[model samples]
Target: MMTDTDITSPVMDGMGPHGTKVGLLRVLGPAHVWALGVGIVLVGEYMGWNFAVGKGGAYAALIACWFAGILYTCVAMIDSEVTSTVAAAGGQYTQAKHIVGPLMAFNVGLYLVFAYTMLEAANAITAGYLFSVVATMTGHTGDLDQRPFIILVIMFLAWLNYRGVLATLTFNLVITAIAFVAILVLFLSTSGILGGGLMEHAALFEGHELPYGWIGVLAAMHFGLWYYLGIEGTTQAAEEVRSPARALPFGTLAGIMTLLIAATLTWYICSGVLPWEYLGDGVNGSVAPLFDTARLSGSNGLVWLLGFGTLFATLASANGCINDASRAWFAMGRDKYLPGWFGAVHPKYRTPYRSIVFLVPIALIFALGAPLDQVITFSILSGLLEYTFMPLNIIMFRKKWPLNSIKRGYEHPFHPLPALTLLTLCGITFFAVFLGYGTQLVAMIGFYIVVSLWFHFWRYRFVNRGTQFTMPWPKPQGY
Candidate 1:
């Protein structure tokens, strides 16, 4: 009974309240809105070591924010343009298929899967870390190991996403709000103790050595990408957005800008309260940096509260990544770049059951590979590569062959300038990751590029051939 149009409609069947209603109108408001972008960046802050390394001896939190603003702005613009054109579920893969080519699109899709899967794994590992912190503070251990903890978290996240977008967003809002409060409390406590109050010393106006050269600035920009990694998550929800053309772009840009400012403020206040020396591997490397700060500030009660808050933040970030990655797979599967199973929606839940099942093992492997900072750095580096390609896709689409058939909703303010700036920053990020992480990172990246290239040429055969194995593109929508 399902018509061809129904299969590809903006509001597909499944994934609604009671599994009956269409679920495309789950417009994310400001609360759940900020969570998507901000939560991603906050992870680096919660895991303080990365911030310390990137921030160096200089207190450049504010300047870092300024630079983050620029980088995120470009990412937002490029994501918006693409999401508007193909507002269905296929996210990056869908856009790249249209602009770049089916094979390149497939590669990007796979990269996203790997990136987000690792993100989820990282979160699950952090969850165990948070639980351990709470246990250590409360003086109780309930037989919880990291591996079991990871499995439980993944299952819970899968259930949450399966419930519906509205439920997921609502939960996201609550957790994100708590996380925000935790951040504020962290800043205040850190400032109250240090010689200079949070505002005076933490402002990061002084002591930064500006990279005198372009390469230096770019090098600095490399470590900073983690501060703005999740700016494009909003695009994954394009199907549910009120106006894909307008809302997707606006929401994405707004989210990135907001996160940039918040991260700057957090770094400033945190650095001011506690010197980098006090934060060691346990606190900096663990999930509850704020709790460590609370303990150092000599407030036991606040430390407990911060423990709860940090747990919430880590869970939120992990949940968001899991949800986003599954959707990306669903989109690609729907396009026939991936297996048909991934494309199939659960008849009742309206969620991508096939993709979720496929994603679980990958996430598990990533979680095991985790437990090290270098692993996280590598995962984040790959993500930067994805971000870099986004702007390139926009330029390619415009110059090589325009997607004029698609209606435009939101366009970038500065045309190619923003895209060009984004392109340059991404190059900086690539080199910085290379320098900071070294040869292993390079080998990893080389592997990714080679794999991506292989799949495109051999697997899909450029989608235009209308292969029966691939997901058939719906008849072009009537203009």
Candidate 2:
């Protein structure tokens, strides 16, 4: 009598030999949840976020940080409530499918996969670059080939994920913590708490006004996502967590809280040490901004420490990206938006082994030869596209299934406030992205349109419309 909606059924992830049930391990707790989210995003603080500085100077980047922080705060709150109830592998894709419908879900799925995979590629490439920096520090390199390190990092982390979720995220937790502390170490040393004299806050800001006006702050907001790009990836753990209700809300909110602290501290520390002219160089912002700041600290120990922190942050990011992207892919496959072949979980490891392995080359494609700026823009645009849908997703979710309709793990207060805040921020961010990278923004929209057509005409047939509504709740309010 087991039905497709029966989450505990043996066939939920499809059957294996001897009729063994295979699915993701539901063993993760809140700390692992924090690690999965913070691990992916801490890399932004270490590097990519300074691009905002490049766009708007240090002051403008700070404005962008505050704005982006508000944007993701809305994301964390809204996503926490939805994912807590849905409790599925796909995160927002699952929420969209169960609440809004499959068309939106399909697009969201693609967004998640592409966003995280590209991020994974970026992290791997950065790892290779950091490795080269280490080599130069050791006095042994004209230039070391980065391809081997990039390939090695991807292959190794994908292998780690293929084995099991428990080990994968547990490893993420350790490195992510060390990396965050490294930032704190740098901050304390530079604040003169540890007897340093590198701060030039008033001196640097005296004449270095924002290169552009408020429009420049808008431009910074676009790149500001680097501060908190992948925290929503925490929700991808819904199906895998020990307690979706407790863990999803707690871990996600906690992760955002941590990011707010980390982002503010990172901006404060770096802005104090480095001038607006160098941190956000008009041509190419410092790739290793924190490390650059560290080297300026007059402490070689801090330099090596930040170096190790950078490497660990990238590794953790690539690892978390692999986890989130594969989950979205696997969830889509489970509902037949993708081939069911990807839906299979490893019989022993209880991980989405097939989906994890399949995405290796997709990530490698961008990591190997793509322009770094384009890769990052592509990733950020993908994430922004996903955020644009959140207001709709939350609005529909509440309308269809009111609070009293069923139990919820967590409920964010001020129904339309968070949703409205999310919508406004999404609008501002879209304009900001369009202002600077208008071509890429339009190109990404077109790319989604092309795939969306493919999904509408061909992929829709494979999706079982009736059966895909798997949330184990009473009938929806209107239905």
Candidate 3:
């Protein structure tokens, strides 16, 4: 239905031929991108991941984590290549637009918006819950609802994002450092409890390791994915990076490697000290698992420190998600995929103020209304759906635009192998989610149907009628 002219036409409102109309400043470097990548999902290192222990026990969960880690590594490699080549704000949405089509790009953009905003909501709620826990520990909690506190946290972070990316990322770097230090402290303190060796603890895991067997391991894949879930979001800031070609790969790789080590230590040490059942039980599914591990050292000071550290970690994740999601929405709006107002950049701050404002209320509603598990399930499904299409994007991009023509700052090793590997892992994970979480899958389907209808009836007909979906960067001359 669409042609090459329709795909490459520049219908961006208020934009010049050189593609600098949106008013986003390039202020981020490799270090800032790395911090944003790590900060966006740092809470996973402290909490939420322990829920996998319930599905597969400690050992099974650990194995599932290993598999998920490999999936992310492959995805990161391919993404870095694409990000360097494209250097766009919307990340995968931009890739989908160029390689696939506008419809597919629309879907990917919506999926990412849902994923990041829902994640932000989840992190905000988790921060509120952690604050309540600390308050309780101090014997000052009567009836902490947490919804109001969550809203307050969201507003605060949104204000920070509205200020500027520099202040936002600098805050991210500081909190991320503190959060990593807290995680290291917990890992070190719990080492003695686990007899100082993961293998030694595994040897004694007859009752601990494979309680639920292969089925449990299969079910835990989703939770295991939580560890490195949002690292790819770093590419969302490509337009704001000083040199995306260099920064995208370095920042994303650094973030993923850091998460890998943290995930290994957190899972092994926490599982060794506490029963897997205890770690992943009840409504919140052990919201403060790392803090619980810290309790093994019998240090009240350490417990309180970790608890506050968990709060800050959640704040950082929520903040980064807001930053990434707003940019995606702004990119879509700039391309006329949504309302024109969403495309507007703040004259003073030069940030996507409209999109940031739009997302806050939605995040607040989700944070207050949805259960923690459901929120996380929805977020994971959205993320997996976005990831599923990425390899295809890479393949199609290469088919259309040969490597010899375009300049690439970084290239993935083995070419298509990494992309193929990512596809296989994504397929397996989707199958697992379908088999394990049927209700959630149905809910996701229902949500998709609603979004599809809105796009068809409203967005397509009203918003994007004559708009041309073009890449922000230049193409090869022959093409």
Question: TM-scores of the models, in the given order?
Answer: 0.82, 0.95, 0.91
Model 1 poorest 10 in a row by lDDT: 1-10
Q: lDDT scores for all predictions?
A: 0.63, 0.87, 0.80
Ranking by TM-score: 2, 3, 1
User: What are the per-model numbers of colliding residue pairs?
Assistant: 5, 0, 0
- The per-residue C-alpha lDDT of model 2 at residue 390 equals 93
Candidate 3 residue lDDT tens string, 55-124: 7788877887899999999888889988877677788887887777777888888888989999999998
Write the residue-wise lDDT of candidate 1 on 1-479 in tens digits.
11122222433422331133433344555445456656655665566333533434333333445575688778777787766655666577667765666666776776677777777777788888777656665787576566777788988987888767667867877787777777776665666553434444434324443323344444555556666666677767766655555666666766776676557656665555544434323334423445655666666767776777777777887777777788889877665566555667766666777787788888887787656565566567667767777887888756643444334565567778988888887766666666666686778768877877677567565333443222223333331
In angstroms, give how far residue 107 of model 3 lies from its true place. 0.7
Backbone clashes, candidate 2:
0
Per lDDT, the best of the predicted structures is 2
Error of 2 at 342 (Å): 0.5
Per-candidate RMSD, Å: 5.7, 2.9, 4.2
Predicted structure 3: lDDT: 0.80
Off by over 4 Å in 3: 1-22, 193-204, 282-285, 453-458, 461-469, 472-479
Model 3: which ten-residue window has the lowest total lDDT? 1-10
**lDDT string, candidate 2, 1-479, tens digits:** 21123333334322321133555778999999999999999999998888898888889999999989999999999998888777778989988888888889999999999999999999998999888878888897587999999999999999999999999999999999999999999988988888856777888888767788778898899889999999999989887877778888999999999999999999998899887867876235578888888888878999989999999999999999999999999988888899988888898999999999999999999999897778888999999989889989989888888887776778899988988988898889898888889999988899999999999999899877677876666766687
